[model samples]
Target chain A: MGEYILAFFMFRYLRLTLRDTEILSKWDKLLQAGMITSAVLLGVEIIFDSVSQYTTWFSYLLLGYIAYLIYWKAEFSQRKSVFVAVLPFVIVSFLTKITSLTSTEFYQSWEDVYDVAGVFSVIWMIVMLVITNKQNKALAREREKTLQEEKQNKIISQMKADLEVQVVQRTAELTKQKEELQQTLDELKNAQKQLIHSEKMASLGELTAGIAHEIQNPLNFVNNFSEVNKELLEELQEAQTNGDLEAVGDITRDIIENEDKIMHHGKRAEAIVKSMLQHSRTSTGKKEPTDINTLADEYLRLAYHGFRAKDKSFNAIFKTDLAEGLPKISVVAQDIGRVLLNLINNAFQAVKEVEKPEVVVSTRHSAEGIEVSVKDNGPGIPQDIKEKIFQPFFTTKATGKGTGLGLSLSYDIITKGHSGQIAVESKPGEGATFTIKLPKT
Target chain B: MKILVVDDERDIKLLFQQRFRKEIKNGEMDFVFAFSGEEALEFLDQLVHEAVLILSDINMPGMSGLQLLERIKTNYLEPPPVVMMITAYGDAENYAAAQRLGADDFLTKPVDFKALKEKLKTLT
Candidate 1:
């Protein structure tokens, strides 16, 4: 009966402790078979008292099966304690069975062995119950720890996902801001291009009167020479009709000379017009081999005459020291012409109030590179504002007289566009000289 | 009459010589040419009373025509030469300024040679 009870409890323990349901179910079926066999044997024992002797062996087989299940299927940690609890009961039973089987006399004399076995079986039951309770408590604590770790892992993953989302959002925002800043910069660049174009037009506007005067002089000559040629031709015809060879020769020479003068003056007028057109048109930024001396001379006269045309009383002795045999440099002619014009105009403006105002434009080929310098004998720039002169919108001129972008634009054209250098040297009360040095390359 | 024609244009000398060829050949009129106001003043300083009439352009480097006129009028008091100012700018301001500075006549270019000749004949 104890064996049957123990088998039932072992089945329950396996059901409770074993994680594999299939294995637990197998153990349950095995235990049921054992109990059914024991029930059958118990029935047989009643029918034939001789079968009672085999009941002990059947109980041993049941105990061995339980031991095998506990040893093989139970958790290694639970197996040791289970074996310790069952060992005393198993040994006591074995001893009782041995005494009963081997020595009938010893068995009758030591009938107390059955009582001892009973006491040990009770202790084993108590130990098994305590160990099961302890294992259950430990399992519950382990399960709680596992649940806590799983929850912490879930929270950490959530925080990581949030951080990734924040990173993406921040990156998106930064990219948008960068795009906006780039757009603004592009707009500003377009505005700057328009401003530079307008400045070029404005300078051309300033030159209009002077260009008119220059062209007018040549045109006047053209008209006058043509009129003179007409008169001379009429005189030559009259002389021819009169048959005076010397007078005819002289008159014919005069007519030819007048025609030549007319052609010369006409060409001059055309050149002036062409230069005016070149100055007014937007630069194509194409570099070509250009004579710097001729460019400097042309712009010097233009700026001088332009200033003189504006203020009739304005006059200065302008000189040119063009170096002979200077090699032509590769440059955008119109751009360099504009730079020269701006510098010469500034020189004229600086020397406006000075007595004996003189401006000198000179070109030279030096070891450094090709250099064009415009020097003036005027009141020089002070040291304080000298460094600021090349900055945009920095002008010492009266308002409305200057746009203040001349030097700054020139600086950009020479340095950024051409990879050159432009510098100003001035001594207070003496004069100022602006020099442009372009590289050979 | 000895006349001094002052202008910055170098071609003016050739043009004047050609225009006044008959007068020059016949010795009826004498002409002197100076390319700038300073040159004209230098010529006048050398030959004090040789030139009786001076035709000067108002715009020239180193010395303007008006400044030259002022100097000529102030310095040459005795038998001062008739000073005529010519300018491309026909503005009233220049005319008034020239007049104020003792310019005997003011003319705008392109100068009408016919009218100028008639004016010169009347002056003579």
Candidate 2:
């Protein structure tokens, strides 16, 4: 049935209509059925007629019909060699049947000829099956390898993307930190600028105040002396007019005394004004040869007087051990004086609360320079705040009572302004000693 | 009426004394001197507003001119004597504090003699 339908299916196979695949599969099955039928018939004829038990030749005819059917269904018309090969197979199959019925000897004579051909064909078929099976297994392994490689690549791509994201985040964080550090640096610079400006203004204010203080005293003296002179003049004129010569002499003597007093006051005030002006002028870093001992004594006395003048009721003894052979030092006299003043003032204030306060000012020549120290037997600065004393605006004084600029300004004057060294040693309740050293000239 | 000149500096008080010497002797005004604000106040306690005018330096030790002026204004309000606060520096904060404390006038050094005279006239 399939052999008869092979021509119709072949047209459909060429056109590739949707129904063609089913039709072709059905035709192949039909052809396969015919081929099996032919094989069965040939087997039946050989097995039954081996002793010539089947007297009929219809079996061979049946095999021939089956072969023809297989040929028709398989569309082997275009393969003429297949028909040629099958004809010989059919002939041998018939001859084998005839010989099996005749005798075993005749069957053995043809066996050797067909056996090799059969063996070769069988080996070729086995080779084809093995090749097909190996191709399927090899395709499966290759597909599996491709899938595994693709998975690995995907994982790598994900890791790369994640790493890129992390790097970007870290870079952004670093940039932010750098900007913050830069901003902090800017703030510090601004604060430094502000502090220096404030210092300049304070120094200028002090200078102006000092000048005003000095000028006021002398101008007052001039006005007072002139008035006194006028009074004396008028009194003398009155005595002269009345002819009381004795009164004139008395008034004249008073006038001279007042004049002398006037001169004395004028000179003192002038000295103060000039000193203030010199203080405000520019100073270079070059050290001048100065009598360190004299400067020390003057500043110590000035410090004592400054405190004594403020609180007259307090009587505190001051001991001085000024060295006699101390050599002059190279320093800025004014700057060193400021440091001495700061140290002395601190000493005095520290001892102000003590029952029996004594300040010891000692001078000696050191290997490095002339060493001068102001020591006080009073409460000392705390260890924690010792370093902070040199910091600007760090003060222990009550507001408005002290400007807190004293020690900081002194530190700058001695270290930077005079090229000298100042140090402090203190113990709580025992006392503090501030030592200053200037290089010997 | 007598006038009191209070200051720490001897030169300042003497200066005022010299400038007004003629008037003081002519029975126009008698002068008392106090070297400090404390001394001036002590004198005030004794004399009880004897001075119709008080010339004071603002920066003296013990008691400032403003403090003394406040005391006088509060304790002795009736016929409150005129107080002319004299300051070496014309510090605005101090001047403002003085004025707020009822200072009669504020003067900056070096004192203008003519201005002093005018202030004296107003006080008298």
Cα-based TM-score, every candidate? 0.79, 0.44
lDDT value, residue B67 of candidate 1: 87
Model 2 regions lying over 4 Å from their true place: A1-205, A227-242, A277-332, A340-382, A388-441, B49-52, B113-124
- Find the candidate with the highest lDDT and give its number: 1
Cα lDDT of model 1 by residue, A1-441, tens digit: 455455545545655665555555655566567666656655666678776676757766767776776677644345556656766776677777788899989988878868777696878768786986798689879988999999998999999999999999999999999999999999999988888888888888878888888888889888887777777788888888999999999988887888888898899788778777887788888999988987887788778778987887788989899989989889988899899999999999999999899999998888867999999999999998898999998888789777889999999999988899999999999999999999877
Of candidate 1 chain A, the 10-residue stretch with the lowest lDDT total is A74-83
Off by over 4 Å in 1: A1-149, A367-369, A398-401
lDDT of 1: 0.83
Q: Among these predicted structures, which one has the highest TM-score? A: 1
Tens-place lDDT digits, model 1, residues B1-124: 7789999888888787777777788886688999988888788887776647899998777788888899999998767899999988888989999999999999999989888877877776
- Give TM-scores of the second chain, every candidate: 0.95, 0.88
State the interface C-alpha RMSD of candidate 2. Answer: 7.0
- Model 1: DockQ score: 0.64
